[model samples]
Target: MYTQCPDCRTVFSLDASVLAHARGAVICGNCETLFDALDTLAEQLPPEPFRLLPGHTRSEEAPKLEVAIYRPREDVPVAVAEAPAAPAFTPGFVQDRRAARKLPRRWPWVVTCLSLALLLAAQVAWAKRDVLISDPTIGAWLRQACISLGCRLPLVRDVHRLHLVARDVQAHPSVPGALMISATVRNDAPFTQPYPVVSLTLSDADGHRLAMRRLHPSEYLDDAAVLRAGLAPGASAALLIEVADPGNRAVAFEFGFE
Candidate 1:
């Protein structure tokens, strides 16, 4: 009979009497560890092709006993490593970060709104330019703006700012059938103003208009003055008017700045 040590997996030969005496308990010779021999014991059978004959007269033979010691392979113990813990998330911290990122996105819309507001304000100012110029403070502001742009504002058509004086009409001594007329137009405005259009009307005895004429600045201003060289504040200009007499029946005439 054969036995194996459970601790060292070492095999040893033993008599049946020795196993009976130890009662299936023995110490490993190689490892010196105590273990039960019966726990490691295995039972085996003969080969299939060999058998005993039925009626054969043969001398008695001692029984051949064979024992095989089976030692199971040992299992190796493995150590398992634990994984690292993940950080916990907080709702307030996450939301604050998201809000910080979204704040920059609003800037473009803000800039666009401001630009639109400025454009609207400029349009309203241009549309109300006439009304703005009527006030002294706003007029000064507008005049400064015009000066910066190298431009001029058109004169207001306020008849109260002008006066007509020194009016006369006489027959032309050199040109017969024609009349020589003269007048003085004055400006009483506080600021320089553009030349006004002159309107002349001839009336008959029946108070019906016979002839009418309107003269523009370019036509009447034959002096060295250009359109931009407007009349000075509180200044006057002499108008030398000439026209053909309508007839003996024409008795009245009118001249004014339109």
Candidate 2:
């Protein structure tokens, strides 16, 4: 029953059930200071310079019990050793500050699931951007990423890869009743496309239909720089058309593309 530590005077051999479960406060495993083990509550050991009993005071009341460090070992025979019961106040830096407050609550759900998986992969790459820009290696890497994102890219039309190749019609040696026609086309697509919509039709010599037209890359491209650079992969172009004579029973003609 001897207890001393009024600030490290270090004595400790406690056990009236460790001072009735420490209602007599304890701490000082060599200077960890805390006091009142019944204020130097002794049963012996009073012969040293230690002094504290004429009406012992120091208890201001706050440490309700937690035990473990009981020091008495002079060759070990002072036996009633029951102090080992401490762990309730959970101190290992308070469980490392509650594991650092559970890492900021899992970093806001790991930054909200990585910002919703990058906004669902940017809405599936903007909803398959025209089937991923018609894939010629993803349309040349999305036209080199839309030229630094200034953004334009749309041309690549396929029109069964456009073909025609050659054609002719006749009689317009200067437009009397007009009817020149002519053609060529080509672009068997490996990528660059665009100029198509030609169509014509005329028929009859029994083929029936008669007079139909469509034309348009500015009415058959009279070369304003090949109507702006389109149709390149395996290129070709020609075209000329004139029109007027859907009479003379149009002797059958046809062609189409768009």
Candidate 3:
């Protein structure tokens, strides 16, 4: 027998045993529509281009039933009867209601894991700010980002990379009992660095330490702008220092950067 789904108008073929097992309720394989199999039931398909009627409606006139009568004739040869072909059954997929219900429950955990990952990255970045800022590539990227963020980075300081190229100490021509110290400091690092504190140590002919002095950037650099700009990479700065003469006892002097 054949039945058509009312919702999707899909035809399916099944036996009386299958229809009885489900009590005429069947699901459509194509549209997954649950409908009664008893409705629109047919023994054979209707003629071409003819619409199938609903279960409740019928033709105005009753369908005529034709009876077949069999008679044996000695002159006609007997033909063998062929068995009917089995009906084709299409299986329908059952929707997983539990899986659909579980889908929404997964989102909270997913969002939480993503937020934790971002938080951990932020913490690591904060803890290693100095190291990351010292890197050539990362520092350049950070500097460009800071421009748009209206933020400033502290100047890099590597005292070991600072060197005193030349230095001299002599009596001040204009000031009595005072000494004038001049030195050229260079930055050998690949990146810009802050001006270093210049330390001058004086010693006697016998190698006995006599006096010590420290000069800050503000004290040595006469230009305010240069003091704020810091020393550029591979650049040198000449600094002049005026101090009271430590006396003839101080014969030798050495400069160190800090």
Candidate 4:
């Protein structure tokens, strides 16, 4: 049976026979407050129905039942005299039961740590985005991820490894007042290099600059070339540029990578 303590409002379980033998009087185990269990005992009494009675008539009260209280004889033998009282029935006494608390599971923390590690790894991958995009094997995986994740690929733009191979400026035969320029640049580094920006300087016969033009990668590379594409070691590209004539005095030109 379940019992609730009135003093501390603590609920606990107890045996019915123990409660009956104790005569409905128990000390609260939680608050250490001695209280009459009979005052707050849980009992189910028979219900009485309401009925109309004549004003002059009187109702008889129900007879009460006599209960016998048992006590040991004072002239009992030595064995009976030495017997002890039941501890549960003693006043100011309570039963002590130590209950262990339950602990929460650890899988939640493990999952959180795993999630944080994945986030850190994703950040590192993004930081080295250019290198991954330039690698043929890794680039294929990255491109598939980009397609699935709805993301754009970043460009590779390292230009220090680019070197000018040959260049020349000549007058256009068909177009009046126009000059044609042709140049070849190579990737001289031991590793692959990114597309480069070319700076063209038109000069007079004495090497004094007449005009300058900056050519972006898009303006020079073919439509098949893309930002994620790279130049292999020792690979070269031929560039063709058209410009309005600088003048008859412009006799030479120079090309450089930025």
Considering every candidate listed, which one attains the maximal lDDT? Answer: 3
> Candidate 4: where are CA atoms >4 Å away?
1-103, 128-154, 189-194, 222-230
Residue 131, candidate 1: how far off, in angstroms? 2.4
Candidate 2: residue 90 Cα off by (Å): 6.0
If scored against the real structure, what TM-score would every candidate get? 0.53, 0.29, 0.52, 0.48
- Choose 1 or 4, whichever is better by lDDT: 1
Clashing pairs in 3: none
In model 1, how large is the Cα lDDT of residue 146?
90
lDDT scores for all predictions? 0.74, 0.78, 0.83, 0.71
lDDT of 3 by residue, 1-258 (tens): 889988778788989998999898999998999988877888888777756644745468987868858766666333423555578755443346655665678788999999999999989988887778778899889888988999877678888889889988889999999999898989987667888888988899999888888988888878888877789888999889888898989889889888
The global Cα lDDT (0 to 1) of model 4 is 0.71
Best by TM-score: 1
Query: Considering summed lDDT, which 10 consecutive residues are worst modelled in model 4?
Result: 50-59
Error of 1 at 145 (Å): 4.1
On a 0 to 1 TM-score scale, where does candidate 1 land against the true structure? 0.53
- Residue 46, model 3, lDDT: 75
Q: Please give the TM-score that candidate 2 achieves against the real structure.
A: 0.29
lDDT of 4 by residue, 26-128 (tens): 7788898765554444443224342221122223876576895887776867766799655556333222221212345678999999999999999998898
**Pairs in steric clash, model 1:** none
Candidate 3 minimal-lDDT segment of 10 residues = 76-85
Model 3: CA > 4 A from native: 1-102, 105-116, 136-152, 222-224
